[model samples]
Target chain A: MAKKSFFKRITLWRYLFLTLCFIVVIGNPFTNYYWDINFIQGWFQSIGIGNLWVVSPLEGLESILTAKFFYMPSLVGMVIPVTLAFLMGRVFCSWMCPIEFLSLLTDKILGFIPKWGKDLKYRKDLVRFAKYTLWFALVAELMITMIIGYPMFVWWSPPGLVGRETMFYVFYKHITIEAVIVVVVLLMNLITRRMFCRYFCPLGALLALIGKKRQLVIEYNASKCVGCKICDKRCPMGIKPSVGESQTVYCWNCAECVDACPTSALKFVWRDRGFITLPKGTKGESAV
Target chain B: MKRERKTDRREFLKVTLGAFMGGALFSSCSLSDLKNPKTMVKSPIKTNILRPPGAVSEEHFAQKCIRCGRCGEVCPYHCIKYFDVKTGGVFSGTPYIDVMEKPCYLCMKCVYVCPTGSLVPCAKEEVRMGVAVINRQICVSWQQDKTGLMCKTCFNVCPFSGVAIKIDHDFRPYIVEEYCTGCGICAYSCIADTYPENNGKKAIVIQPIKWKKIKEIKLEDIKKS
Candidate 1:
């Protein structure tokens, strides 16, 4: 429960994760070495072993499970992020999402101006709802495509659109409709607060649902609570850990609450099982 | 708290417009390379036995490839890769077969497990997809007074077991048109040619194309061979 450095801490992890993401997005040696082989692609194509359900093809692993009923392996990318979400509740948004970092940096930059200049608006609820709606549509479209043997969602995933279109424009000087979609999505992120993640990302929601009951979660100790409400203010997702249960689906386990707690009342514990309360004679007890 | 209301309105407009744009403006630009003849290469086999046509391409391949380390997974010869999506779109989120270190041996496993038809069946037959064409002029066997040892590199690198291409007594390399599956192993493993200007590698770059039958070699042609 010892006080943690603010900008020094979060920015470190953020920068590291963003750099990896950049490498993934741009052609780096890692992807070329690990991702290109047929066996690995085949393994990924397989469903039970971890076929990303979102936008990957239904041919290899999907073919066996659904008999080619539904396929889209790009969803496999969600495995790590979704798994992290379950353990730490949307940690991907906080720790490793390139898009989230982009928006956060933009928001900070925008903060420099006063009045309307810095006070940009975000459509978290409605646009964020779009991510869920898009998820629903993706599922519905996937189901239909499975039965009909057509690729509905895969044809137009935003990730695919941006990846293909932007590269095409840059490399070949040609812009397709997919490239336009990438632009629109970026503009949306620019205006809103992580709109793609809040509304459009089905994988995020799936992980969030699982994370609500994860074994490890953030805990608020009422005994140490001064009720200063600093933790509430520090939460990026607008979650209130002080008033109620800390097991909310939006909690990303960023440890921001732990860092923000002036009295060191907040702790991230594995379940309610391990109780590592503030060290007896340290600063937290002194504050108490 | 004071800025929350206007923030909410602005948020709404942006999300609504974004979703609308994502849906309305979306198109598959990944397939642009297929349209260009310069990037297109013809396949060897006429009757493709793999995934149905219209199913395999850069865009379709991108969605289907799970970014798994598999194709790279089973390669005794590590030549495949899951391309990144953000970089130049050439191989985004798809498996790109690298023949630089070692070329493919006409093994169709890549096509078989593609989960999607990114690498189609008859990939071997689709010599247009990944065939090895030689730069004969740069080939040591074809030119230069250096020891012929460097010349047979293409013939030595060929994995079709000498059926596709052969080494002449003079150490000249000749491709057997009928036997060559166009796997590109020969071109990829060729030690004689090193040209950086043309994609920083040797070998003729083949692209996947629609399959068609290759004409039969005549007996007189065999005598010439």
Candidate 2:
């Protein structure tokens, strides 16, 4: 049989979406000219989708820590994405995060380079719980340091670094140390798939916490089981989605597993019941 | 019993990992920078740089601004620039207006777009950006009237003429602190600005000081011939 077209599938919409957002972010009409040289960064700063962030949750948490409730617009920014995370799972990780997109692309590109290999192989359990630990500690630090007036994690956020660098490099043709650091992190994906994201992204950790109770999620059916382990290998975060069906938040819902499932047993359950087979007619369809 | 022991070990590991990452992040950024990078050694030429109009005190502004760059987008004159990492990691993302490159035109849009109160929202008339001070020594208007070097660039461009800035009987320009909003329009529009001796500096320049520092300009401060 002919191989399935990755671009002709539902998951491709996400790649298309992130690519468009990348364009809008880089095309931000922000800065005024300095010496007729346009030094641009963060023009669509308010245009949330372009950067996939209006403001970070850490910014809101900082305001809450400082007790500036009446005027905290950052809290409002936080609410929108968290609400969306509740609606779906960690769709931010797969669909919208530029760093995630860059890392995934790096993983693909590195496949082409001869002799390039993933050097550090971590135990799966440690990687699974790593993000949660990061989220908790960053929040803990934010609460402790709020009195001193610092937005702590905003200093080296992956999303902000990607957004800011793209804008600067595309428009101003400038690259600073912060931009270089993000690129270095991107380059590390050549050594380990989604390395920075899997290990250290606090924003993803926060969203995953919010998305743990997500109503729309993947349902595993034993009736159609062949135990092929295709979906097991497909998960980007290395979560054994075939085994840990209950661990919904860790799943990016990229539908590569559903695409990879030979029996087509894996399907998205919305307002789910126990065993709703793919509605008879649409046996092999997944649209998100 | 085995399950309970495993859970305890996992909990211990999680907390240790959490504290380590947390401590590493916190100390590595601001704390470590203090000792190693010295990123926040204070911009030695701090005051001369113009901030967005209605901007709070520099110290508070630096702390308050999350540096999203919203002000730069809505700026009709597009005057705001985010200070990059070159400006110390602390000040890197804050918006600043470089007067020599692009001065604030008193659009007051930036103040409106500022998500935080880093740039306070105030009317154009109320925006005291910085005081436009004149150097009488090099001002052509201050030179010999008989030498035919008298200029009216400052007077013609003053947003609030006859009040904020005034041309005296002798044609020398004087600033009135009470009425001057420090919009920097007069300074931006100064034609008598020249190079070589002044190195292309404006004859009239806006000094980036808070309005509270202007000290009720005593009438005797200005020398009238």
Candidate 3:
């Protein structure tokens, strides 16, 4: 009998965590309705228990920009998420975001269809440019929020829409047009896997910037690697993990690549090893 | 590769410059211009639709609110509801109370739960959600002799009772606009709407006060109240 790898164990826990986050996001309204248990309230935009709050950093930043005033409670609410990003390198993208959970499900469902299942191929430079577009979108979103005097992203944020739609369904018995936005984004996963997380999500962009120097990171072992590129194929973020592309801030610490590495060359280590320097003879392909 | 890089850089520069120019144009148009009453883009305020207690001015509420839905979640009476995307553009997902369906009980739980100060915490008495206006024409008590019906449902159900509502010499209900909190309990309990003869019309209805119209409602007053 073969033993299970540590990465598999982490991936299993990630799935469980993601499922739990989905339930918490969508089930709060039902629990509030049926059992009257509302100790925990809110969704991805801002969730809290009692007085302790965990607000989205991007939303908090927008609030600060649009309101044009320093609000103490909201500022305090941002501390937890910002600190988590600092330590964990945007783990929330994989482990907590309900939209990411739905995206993963869409990926799985798409896998059954032969033609649609394959990952979309793009030029190496184009992929890098696409990654850079996340930053561009983030800046554009924030500036728009400031100019418009409202947090525009919150209006159509996938996870927020899911949470609100769930609440609306539970209470009002009708779904709004926001649900269509969520459905469209989820359906787009068929063409490009996790497109929103990779190049469009402003929250993910903000987290990537904050978690750029995160403590926990995927470390590559050159000696153990077989140059099989399975990890590259497994990465949802479209980065090659075996050659230390996982070290990029875009890597959400999902450990999908780690789990896919048959030789156990890639593992999450709690140390900031910085960027990897390529070996003497090996070419660094798609290093970004 | 060198030529491709040059074009890419040029494309990036063009995009960034365009975005900067657009942003500068928008910023040049002052906030006051956007907020001007003459602007048709302003969200139309409805009469019976009231913001939850302690809500800031409508202009600031949409800007400050992150739409966490905590206000609706914490509402004990479940009267607070969100505006959907179709009905609400900037106002979508923000909390509102439709008094005719279920009126605010003034638990003030929603105010405390709001992470942003879109709904500031305040005393129940100081909450000016709107003012209740009594329609004497349909009121049962006002037309007791003619209709042979004497009902004081609004007076009995009012949270402020005597202070917010008072009886005239003829025992007809009269709303004291100064003291009315506009919680809409009176409108919700009004018997005039229940009577088939009155054609389902509420005698006492809440007329929402525009946040801009109330010049004295400072943040300090909200806190102190």
- On the 0 to 100 scale, the lDDT of residue A203 in model 3 is 91
Model 1 spans with C-alpha error above 4 angstroms? A1-15, A20-86, A113-183, A222-233, A272-288, B1-64, B67-225
Structure candidate 2, residue pairs in collision? B195-B200
lDDT of 1 by residue, A146-262 (tens): 443323333344544433443334333455544555456567766455566556554455556656767556767899898888776555555678975466666666665676787
Q: Weakest 10 consecutive residues, lDDT, candidate 2 chain A?
A: A118-127
In candidate 2, stretches whose alpha carbon ends up further than 4 angstroms from where it belongs are A1-8, A30-45, A48-54, A63-69, A72-74, A111-131, A140-148, A169-173, A245-248, A271-288, B1-45, B143-148, B189-195, B199-202, B210-225
The digit string of per-residue lDDT tens for model 2 on A1-288 reads 234576756557767887776655555543233332223334222343333435555554554454343345555656676777776767877777777667666655655666543322221223234545546655665665464454545545666766666545543467657777677777656555566666666667666777777766777777886888877766667666677552456676777676677776676756333334456555434434
Look at candidate 3 and tell me the lDDT of residue A43.
Answer: 93
Q: lDDT tens digits, residues B1-225, model 1?
A: 869998999999999998885443222223323432332322111211112222354324433433433344344445543333232132233445544544566555544444433445553434433334556655656665643444566666665545567766776667655655545566566654454543445533333434334445343543444
Candidate-wise lDDT, in order: 0.48, 0.61, 0.79
Give candidate 2's error at residue B97 in angstroms.
0.4
The predictions' CA RMSDs to the true structure, in order, are 13.3, 10.2, 9.4
Q: Show the colliding residue pairs in model 3.
A: none
- DockQ of each model against the real complex? 0.10, 0.18, 0.53
